[model samples]
Target chain A: MDKTINQKAWFLVLPVFAVVAFSAILPLMTVVNYSMQDTFGNNQFFWNGVGWFKELLDPSTDLGGRFLASLGRNLLFSAIILAIEVPLGIVVALSMPREGWTVAVCLVILALPLLIPWNVVGTIWQIFGRPDIGLLGYTLNTLGIDYNYVSNEFDAWATVIVMDVWHWTSLVALLCYAGLKSIPDAYYQAAQIDGASRWAVFKAIQLPKMNRVLLIAVLLRFMDSFMIYTEPFVVTGGGPGNSTTFVSIELVKIALGQFDLGKAAALSLVYNLIILIVCWVFYTVMTNAGVERPAKKGGA
Target chain B: MARIDLVDLAHSYGGNAAPPESFALKPVTMTWRQGGAYALLGPSGCGKTTLLNLISGIVTPSRGKILFDGADITPLSTQKRNIAQVFQFPVIYDTMTVGQNLAFPLKNRGVPKAEVDARVKQIADLLDLTPYLGRKATRLTADAKQKISLGRGLVRSDVAAVLFDEPLTVIDPELKWQLRSKLKALHRELDLTMIYVTHDQTEALTFADTVVVMHDGRVVQSGTPAELFDKPAHTFVGYFIGSPGMNIVPAAVSGHEARVDGHTIGLHRNYGVLPAGTKIEIGVRPEFLHVAAPASGLLSAMIERIDDLGRARFARVRVGDEKFSARMPPGFSVPDNMVGLVFDPAHVHVYADSRLVEGVA
Candidate 1:
């Protein structure tokens, strides 16, 4: 067979390459350059060769201690939020109205929080948690509770977690709802014919069908909660003795507040790498879960 | 197995107060005896599915009661009805193995594990699904998944009746015959009451002992395939059943003859007089109506086309403004456009207002 390869196709891709270079590659290259070198203001620089990464990973040095502490906090926050959100999202999806006008109303209400800007969400919760004036705080205090997000570490964490859940749980619920909706009515009817209890139906039919969407919900909720910044920063300012100081806040403190560009750049690279690896793992596991062969034998 | 009966059962998606014209299933009263193989056959939107769902309890009839072997089960839930229904599309649990899928219904009913295993094995073997028992059901072919659905329905030995709602729609054409024969064998071996629903007449006629014909939301006729073929009770049945179907043309019926386009065709039975002011027509299957050389006595027709269907030949003929299909006798070539139609008096049925009219013998 005579085959001719087209060389002109390369030119067709040049526009996309140019766009990506300016939008992503160029900024990322600059970060990589900064991460590899030490700078002493006024554009002065020197190569340090993985020194910042080593320190950031270590727990003894000041940068290392702060980075590790905030990383731990970020991991914990991601864990807590995912544990709460995934099941809560599925429950919300299951309880959603199946038909009629109420379905549209419920969908719009579910989407309300997602439409709010990130900073707006942060600001709303910031004021909402003020013990003296905010509804939540005032109500809690009136119920004989010592709830002050501004002063208590536990309260700060609680307020941030609740705020994040309020802001993002809707995304998970909507995805799960979409998955649930895609299930045909035949499945429910079949389950009914099989004499399956409600729980059996959920376990055997609903959960398996929702698997793909729940994976997405977990991945999004995990990444979002891990890199949480504005909400906690606005609500507690990562205060109450660095209780809710997630890694993004720490990175910002190093890069912009302290103007330690090298450290911030190194932290940024590590953070990006972590997210990429975690996302890769999630995608691999989830997509595999969809078509995996747990039993590969005895079939022709 | 239990005998099922639908007593004055009806359903209207628009609610009970809706007009009669809006009912998805017009009031139907029938009995499906135990261990009987029945097929509800009709075109799309003919309420065969509505009837099947009503029996399965997936749909609650808008009015009237359903009984299982004389016990009223109208108010019972689907689970309480102990009926199994396979849907139009395969509805297997994706997470389960083929064996697990087959075992699901039994497990749900808290049947003994050993019995569940044995029953699942029997059903799986019956379906030729033994090799895939440990394989995930979702990984199988469309037909295999459908087999799993069927197996799930059959694994429960004591179901009131196994309902199939066009279960073979997704199966490959080649596999359809294989699966259909397998179902016939299972029906015999299990002695379970199976109600198959489909729009295809061949599937209904071959798979069912009694094919129930539905039209415009009403059960038009329910009889053996031979009965439906030999004597169609309604005009729709006459038109819907046979391959070429029954030929129906408007005519004026009086005494022992039906006049078609000013030509008289003799009838075996004497319909002394049909109701006055009512439209009259005659229905004859192409099998009985033969095409012959043009003659003065026989009803004259203009032959438009002749279709050789391999096994038999048929001529499409026009009598005045009406068209018909008539059997072409063996080796009887068409002689120009003019032809004579010979209608067997024994098979000729007169219709009044699109319904069969009984004549005095």
Candidate 2:
């Protein structure tokens, strides 16, 4: 038998690389160019070596304060979202039926929220959370809860978190649901025969079986929440003060709101690097935890 | 260990009693003895799996009492019933090591650390899975994962029964044979009440002490494999239990004889008082039918095709409008134009209205 390597397979990947480089690399190079130099009016440039990077890191400066605050907020937001969504998703998934037209209906309902655009989700929450006119705010206020997202930082943060949960918990639910549905009924039978309690079944069979997808859900929610801009921007405008301003919001404020393009470029670069670093850590830890250990040769 | 009894169990999915219905399983009443190995054998959608599920308490019976050791447990949840089930496909935790998978039941029961380890080792040794115990179950082969499933079921000795629902369907054919033998040995060694369900007759016949032949949700007959093969209570069982299956020819019965297409086969015993114009079928296994000289037999047949299996030759023959299979010794030559079938009259079964005639056996 003669086996030859087919170099023609490279043709299939060339188009993909071409598109990625054209769309991704060109803008990235522009950002890198801006990050390295100081630009004045009309595109006049001067080299300011590491000055913006140093300023963004210094705690005494306003830029550093906003940067660190937003980073803290982003981390906190991701933690809260994960704490709420993952368990809720698993519960919803387990409650679903295993077969029939009901599964189809539930799947369609679960997927409807994911199909909506992210910006549209922001707009929906914006209208849906108004104190006087919005249904949620009106209901809460009528019930005498004093819900005001505009003036209250806590209310603004809570509303954003809740809105984000409503919009994106479906993604985690769908993923975990796929994991749960893939589990053969045999596992349930085994758990039953073991005389496992409901908690034990969930802890031993369901949770361990769903670990891979849960890790994926955690990573996705972390990245999305850390970089979340549109929904919070539209809903709270990062306000009552800077309480709800995440990293992406602060970056947008530096670039478009303040027009300090050079510093904004540097901050954006640092922001991208931080996300990259965190994502790397997340990927490494998750992949390690999720790694299927190779079978040992001989042990019981 | 407890004997499981299913009393007057009937299931209708739609709650309707119309004929030619769509119910997945019909009414059934049977008992599995304590520490006995029984198999429910049928083709797909034949309700064998449903019966197994009902026995395991996974599904509540619509109309029956499931008694474990003479206590009604029909309404009980599967957990309370203490029945372990190995599925057709592997169901071990992919994230857990094989040792952890085997030890899950023990851990759930809050067994002591030493006892859990001891039981895991015992099951691992029984299943020949000791070498793979520390390996992640997900990284193992399909057969290995299935072995883990089996080991998990066998690890716990306190269960009332361990049920296998076509547990070898996903295994390789050669490996299926090996596993079937291992299961038989396990059943004997452990003395656990085992109910195995499979559509394959070979597995059922080889592994089970009593084979429950099911079709369309009803247990048509429950007996030893030999009894099912030799005296199939229903025509479906007659056709399902053998490789070439039993040959059933529609006939008209008169006195101690059955006449098929103007040819009569005499019987040693009389079917007393059969209806004047009753529709009947003569059933005979292929193994019992012999191809001899045309003049010496009851009926003549035309040889259609000869299947050369290594140990035996199956001659597919046509007798009038009906077709029948006759098994012969390997290398037996078939005559060119005609073949005559000679079956012992004592071995023939007469079925009326799809049920065995009373006292025929």
Candidate 3:
């Protein structure tokens, strides 16, 4: 049986093509244009011919130096958040009540931090970390520890990390919870009948079942943490000596603060490329470790 | 293998002490002999799963004791009970290889590595899963996955008994018979006491030596397939066991005869006085009902339709307002408008309130 090749199916796909072009492809083209050219007022431009990319990539250059530093900070922040939040989220997901109104209450409370606007989270943490009157800082100072987020680099870094973890760990926990709930009751019953220990059950059954969502949690937390700007910008203002300036804050400092559009656009492209490469790497490794990926629709 | 005895065991899904109607499993006191294959045959929601869970210690009985080989195991967990259960859907460790999946139970019990490998290899070969020993369990087809689950049960030598909760449900139709026969062979080879739960009569009759028929939380009847087909203890059994099961007709009973719609009919043996408040009905299999010319048989009936079923022709005959199916021999001419049903008196079974009444010889 041969399928008749009707070429008209492309018409059905035309709308999606148009939407992607106007919303994404066109704006991306503008970024590419800005990345490769230098403009000096009055809409006049000169071809920089990859000069921006070259400048951005060279750590010796001022633009490249700033970008590399922020990139390192972004990588470090992502690593720390992923390491802290993933395990903590899984623990929280495991301890979560399985049923009843308490489940609803816990879920609502867990979701409250996620629902708060990012900048408000920053504002709240800024006021809460003041050693003068705020409870946390005041308590720490009264204990004679000399805690001050405003003047200490380490305190600023700690405050930003804590704020980020407080704002986002619930998302990971919730994803992991959904994954846990998807495991059928039969698996646990079978494990018990097989006389498997609790650790064995977690290792063989629960963890394997949670792998997909953990992948999601890791990827989302990685990408989001790497791009964090608003909260840290509000609290530490990239802080006590530019200690907490992640790549996004640096990009904004170049693009809007100093109005270096060419350099910023070039940095933005590199940042996006890094994210795409890292996500691709993570996706490949996680999927391969899962034995075989679930077959995609219409896929073999 | 161990002989399992349920001593007045009962289960109710309700959180509180439930009334009789709410009980998922009525108090059942029966023993499944060691080295015998038994089937719990019932419709969906007929408490077959509940019974299987109780046996596997997945669900503790609401009341009474479960004894395995004379030791009370009612207070034990499924782990301590040393039971193996294959769920309705195949439960395999997706992350493990076939050999690893088979070795899971043995390893979990702290069996030595060499013995675990030997057991896994032996069971995998027995189940024809040797070719897939190194392959991941998740990549297998449904039937293969099911075989792996069964292998998990077989890998352990210290298991008290093996319970299957319709393990063949996910298998393909063509592969189901193959898997079922393989399971039966495994049972005999291992000499394991196995209990299979299924609603399909063919699955039950073909796989099990004794089929325990359940209905609405009660064991309506438990017997060999031959006994269930030849003599159903209850009306539900008569209506449930055989393909196109026994035909039951409401009748009024006297000492030596039964009357259907006021027509007097003869019985094989006299049933002594039926008790008051008894609901009388006559059960006779279609195989025993003879079709004859109109007015020459027990009760004249109008022929509704005849279905040709390869070897047998099933004729629908209407007696009074009720329809009954009769198995007709090949070349027996079925009348277009009228026929008579001659029920073999030797096959006549009289039911009083859904229970079979003994014939007084």
Candidate 4:
């Protein structure tokens, strides 16, 4: 039986690998080439020998001095988003009914914002936060609160965070909702028979069951928040003295604004590597949590 | 153990003065003795599960009260009622070990750690799950997982009643017999009040001391296996409880004789006060009837088919325009076209308008 086989099945997977390699590997090679060389006008290039990497890693007399701080901000933003969005999504999912017209209505309404383009979300918030005529800005000023997102770094960061929340919290909520729906009613009945309190039921049954989807939500949200550029870029233009400037925004400044392709390429590679490492860690932890141990004797 | 009483319980999902005729379960009043093993037996959509759920407080009754040990608990939540239930499918914490799954109820009730460990071991030993206690429940086979679910219910000694809703449906055929006997033994050893609900008549009859036969939202009869088999209160119970089921033939009664399919069979006793126009039917179990020579029998039948069932063979025959089954022992030869059926008059039951005619001969 082990020797009997047909090798034709390999044909089925050829197209997928080809498409992935073309899209992922080719661009990655171009980025690697750009990272190691200096390019002047007219497409001329010269070898630089890791000069950009050394400069970026240094702490003084380089724009890369702020790299560590920006990385820290990115991590902080991801953490805050996960803490707020995951719980908020779960709550909203639980509040929806198991069946009925209301469930459909709520789901559709929650999904409407996620379908809009990211750039459009930035523009909408940019206009909406105007102090002179925008509803939020006008309301705040009328309420006698001093608010200027254009000049205040704190206001700019707050506005970007809130905008991101509005645009992406629904994704997390929808995924968690799918996870919640997959749980059988028998578990609930068993929990009831066990005399578990509401908190205990949530902690033991709901949370453990939702571990897989929550991992996906955390990883996706982390990557999205860390690489966030469009909304904050359109709204703040990375302004207010670089206070709200994330790594992506910083990369854009290096490549397009200053036209330093080599340094930008190196920074982009670092950004990709950090995301890859974090995602790998999350996947490993989540997969390990899902592995079930085989039974042994006399332990009960 | 507790004496559970359901007093005039009726439920309706919508607002209506009278429950819709299509109500899943009609009003029912019944009592189960403490430590008695009972089963609710019926086909699908027969409201057996609704009754079980109502008793467990998973569904609150729209009318009347449920009492446990003489105290009203109809309005209480399921957690407050302390009734353990094993569902049709396995329900256990996949993330937890088998021992943890069994100990969850005890831990939730704030039982001491030592007692919880003791109770867990006791149930594991009883269920033959001692060897798999440390293993994660999700990694077990379907039968093993079901055992974990059963143990979870049995581990809690403080539960008022253990309600099993077709818990053996997922078990394999061979293991089903073993588990059924194990459950029966568990009931005797623990003396816990148990209510098992199943559509399978064999499981209900063998496992339960008292079988509550239900049909279409009503309890047709509640009796021991012997009584339910010998004399069923309703026609549905007669058809449902037996292997070949009771053969019901429409007849017209005149004095002490019942004219069935243009042939008359004498009755040992007369049914008095029955109107002449009333619809009557004669019911008899196939085992009580025997095949005989044509002239010596009460009626003649055309043998249609013979089913060879190892120890006994059932002859399906056509008597007049209706078909009836007669049980015959193995090695008995059935004649073609012409066959004779002789039934004891004492074992015959007469029904008028779906209700048994009490005191009828």
Writing each residue's lDDT as its tens digit, candidate 1 over A169-243 gives 899999999999999999999999999999999999999999888887888887888788887887788888888
Question: Compared with the true structure, what per-residue lDDT tens digits does model 2 show for residues A1-300?
Answer: 899889999999999989988999888888888877886668788888888899889878988888888888898999999899888888888898888999999989988888988888888888888888999888999999999999999999899999888988888989999888877776787678767788877877788778889888988888888889998988888998888988998998888887778888999999889889988998888778757655554333
Clashing pairs for model 3 are none
Q: Which candidate leads the pack in TM-score?
A: 1
TM-score of chain B of 1: 0.98
Interface quality of candidate 4 as DockQ: 0.60
Error of 2 at A33 (Å): 1.5
Best-to-worst TM-score order: 1, 4, 3, 2
In model 1, pairs of residues that clash are none
Native-vs-model 3 lDDT? 0.88
Off by over 4 Å in 1: A1-3, A294-300
Q: Indicate the TM-score of model 3.
A: 0.93
lDDT of 2 at B324: 91
Looking at candidate 2 chain B, the ten consecutive residues that score lowest on lDDT are: B12-21
lDDT of 1 by residue, B36-97 (tens): 99999999999999989988888889999999999999999999997999999999898888
Look at candidate 1 and tell me the lDDT of residue B330: 94
Cα lDDT tens digits for candidate 4, A202-272: 88788888888899888889889989988888998887888878899889888998888898899899889
Among these predictions, the greatest DockQ belongs to 4
In model 3, which runs have C-alpha deviations exceeding 4 angstroms? A1-27, A37-48, A292-300, B295-297, B334-336
TM-score of each: 0.97, 0.88, 0.93, 0.94
Better of 1 and 3 by lDDT: 1
TM-score of 4: 0.94
Q: Go through the candidates in order and give each one's C-alpha lDDT.
A: 0.91, 0.84, 0.88, 0.86
